[model samples]
Target: MMNRLFGKPKPETNALQTLDKLNETLEMLEKKEKVLLKKAGQEVEKAKEYTRSKNKRAAIQCLKRKRLYEQQVEQLGNFQLRIHDQMIMLEGAKATTETVDALRSGASAMKAMQKATNIDDVDKTMDEINEQTENMKQIQEALSTPIGAAAEFDEDELEAELEELEGAELEEQLLQPTTVLPSVPAGRQQARPIPKRTAEEEELAALQAEMAL
Candidate 1:
C-alpha cells in the first residue's frame, strides 16, 4: 500500500503520464479493498458458524482475522484518498502551467509585431494615405464641374453698357411730338375750341406734312 501510494516516477514522465499511473494505482487499491471487505464478511460468517457449534476458541480466531482484514481495507481506502488528492493537485498544476505558456506566447507575438512596425513607418504610411485622398478629391471636383462653366465676365463693363442704353431710352421719350394750335389774326384774337391731339397722331401728321413738302 505504501509503495503504491508513494510511487516514484522516472524524470521523463510528464504530468499526463503521472496522472495515468495514479489512476491505475487507485483502481488497484479499490479492488484490493473490496476483496478485503469480502474476506472480512466471510470471516464473520465463519465466526458465527463456529459460535453455533459451541466452539468458542475457533470463533475468537475468526473474529481476530476479520478485524485484520478490516484494518487492511481501511488502509487501502486511505491510499485511494491520497491518490485522488495527488490527481487533483497535478491537474490543477497542469492547467496553471498551460495558462502561463499561452500568455508567454501571446506576449512574444505582440512584441514581434511591435518591432516590425515602427512609428516612422506608421507616419509615412499615413502621409501617403493623405496624399492619395487629396488627389482623389481633386479628380472628383474636376469630373463633377460642367465644361466652360468657369468663363469670366467683366461686371463693371456690363454695368456701364446697361446705363448707356437706359440714357438713350430717356432721350427718345423727351423727343416725342407735342400738341400745336394755328395762329389767329390780331382783330379776332378771341377764345376758340381746338381739337386735342394724341402725341402719336401729332407726330404722324408732322411726318406726312414733311413728306408732302
Candidate 2:
C-alpha cells in the first residue's frame, strides 16, 4: 500500500522537470531558428555573388546550405508547437482546479447563510420597516399643514375690491375732457413791421431839438 502511494512521486517530479526542460529547449530552438533564418539570407547573397563571378559549383553549394537551414527551421517550429500544446493543457488544468475551489467555497457560504436567517425574523423586520415608513409619511403631512390663523381677506371681500378698482377706472375716463385744436393757414409766415420814419416824425424831432436849445 505504501509502495502504491509513493511509487509514482519520483515519476511525477521527473515529468515536471522534463516539462521545464522542454520549455527551455523550445526557447533555445526559437533562437536558433532566428539565427538560421539570418544565415539563410546570407547564403542567398553568397549564392548571388558566386553566380555573378561565374562560379556555378560554389553558388549551388550556397543554395544547398540555405535549404538545409530552412529544414532545421521547420523542425524547430514543430518543437515549438508541441510546447504550446503542453502549456495550453496545463493552463486548462489550472483553470479547472480554480473553478472547483470557487464552487466549493460558494457552496459552504450558502450553507452558512441558510443557518443564519429565519422566516419569522424576516417577517418581523418587514413589519417594522412598513411601520416606520407610515410614521414618516404622517409626520411629513402634519408638517405641511397651515397653522391656526384667519385669512386677512375672504373671497367675497377680494371680489368686491376688484369691482371697486374697475369702477374708479370708469369714473376717471368719464371725467376727462375732450379737446379740439384750431386749424392753421398754409400761407408764408409774416413778421410784425417796424415803424417808418416820416416828415411828421422828422418835424417832431426837429421841434424837440429847438425847444431844448
Candidate 3:
C-alpha cells in the first residue's frame, strides 16, 4: 500500500547514465567558464581603451563588467568541481555494488550445489568406485598370469637335468683345442736367443704350433 501511494519506489538510478550526465554538465560548465573568461579579458581590454580615451566613467563601467564576468567564471568552475566530485562518488558506488552482487551470486550458486548433492549419494558413489577398482585389479591380475602357469613341475628332476647340462659343458671346454698365438712375421722378427723350455712346456708349445697349422 505504501509502495502504491509512493508510485512504487523509483527503480534504482542507472549509475552509468548519471555519470554520463555529470560529465556532460561538467563539459558545459567548462565551455561556459572559458567563454566567461574570454568576455572578462575583453572587458579588461575595453576598460584599458576607455582609460586611454580619458573617459573615467566608461572605464569604471567596463571594469565592473569585467568583475561580473570573472565572478560567473568562478561560479562555473565551482559547478564543474561539484560535478567531478559526484562522478567520482557514483563510480565508486557502482564498483562496490557490482562486487557485492558478484559475491552474492557465487554464494547462492554454492548453496544450490550443496542442496543438490546428498551425503548418502556421495557415499554410494564412492562405494561403487571402490568396487569397480577392485574388479579391475582382479581382471588385470588374471590377464598378467601366463597360460599353463599353474601347472606343477618336478623340482628334483629339473635340478638333475640342469646338473647334467653343466657337466657336459665343462667336458666340452676341456676337450676343446687351445687358441694359438700368431708368430712374428719373418721380416719383422729380431734376431734374439731362444729361451729354453721344460719338457712339459715344449710339448705344450709343439701342440699349439700344430693347432696353428
Candidate 4:
C-alpha cells in the first residue's frame, strides 16, 4: 500500500513496455501455432497413408492424434487473437496516457503563471501606468500653455489700453505742421524791404529835395 501511494506512474512508458512484451509473446505463440499446424497436417497425411494401405486401426489412431494436434493448433490461434487484442488495447492506452500527460503539463504551467501574476498585481500595474500617462499629459499641457495663461484681463482695461494708444497716435498727428501756400506768378515779383540809412544821409536827401523845389 505504501509503495502504491509513493510510486510514480509512467503510464505511457509502461503501456509501451506492456505492448512490446505482448507482441513478443504473440510472436512466440504464432511460432508455436505454426508448428502445431504443421504437426496436425503431418498427422492427417499419416492417417491418409494408413487408410490407403488398408490398416484401419492404425488409420484410426493417426486420425485421433491428428484431431488432438488440430485442437492444440486451434487453441494456439485463439491465444494469438487474444494477444493481438491486448496489444491493440495497450497501444491505444499509451496514446491516451501521452495525451493526458501533455494536457496535465499545460494545465500545471498555466497554474504556475497564474500564481506568479495575481489580479491585484495586474490592477496595480495598470493603475501605475495610468498615473504615469496622466502625469505626462499634464506636463505636456503645461508646456503647451502660453505665458500668463492664468492671468485674466478685464475687457474695460483692454479697451482703455487701445484707446490710449489711439489717442497718443492722434496727438502726434496733430503736432505736425500743415501748410497750404498758393504758387506765385512769374510776371509779378515782390519788393524786398529797404535798408535804414544814417541821419546825415537822410538830411542830405531832404536838402536836395528842397533845392529841387
Among these predicted structures, which one has the highest lDDT? 1
Query: What are the per-residue Cα lDDT tens digits for candidate 3 across 1-213?
Result: 886786654223567778778888888888888898999999899989999999999999999999999899888888888888888888888889889888999999999998789788899999999999999999999898666744466678889999999999999999999999989887897679989889999999999999999
Taking all chains together, the TM-score of candidate 2 against the true structure is: 0.41
Alpha-carbon shift of residue 29 in model 1 (angstroms): 0.5
TM, every model: 0.57, 0.41, 0.55, 0.62
Model 4 lDDT tens row, 49-141: 999999989989988888888888888888888888888877787788789889999999999999899999999999999999999999999
Error of 4 at 39 (Å): 1.6
- Global local distance difference test of model 4: 0.87
Cα lDDT, all candidates: 0.90, 0.87, 0.87, 0.87
Instruction: Tell me which residue pairs clash in candidate 1.
Output: none
Error of 3 at 1 (Å): 18
Report the Cα lDDT for candidate 3.
0.87
Displacement of residue 68 (Cα, Å) in model 1 is 0.8
10 residues in a row with least lDDT, candidate 3? 6-15
Off by over 4 Å in 3: 1-13, 128-213
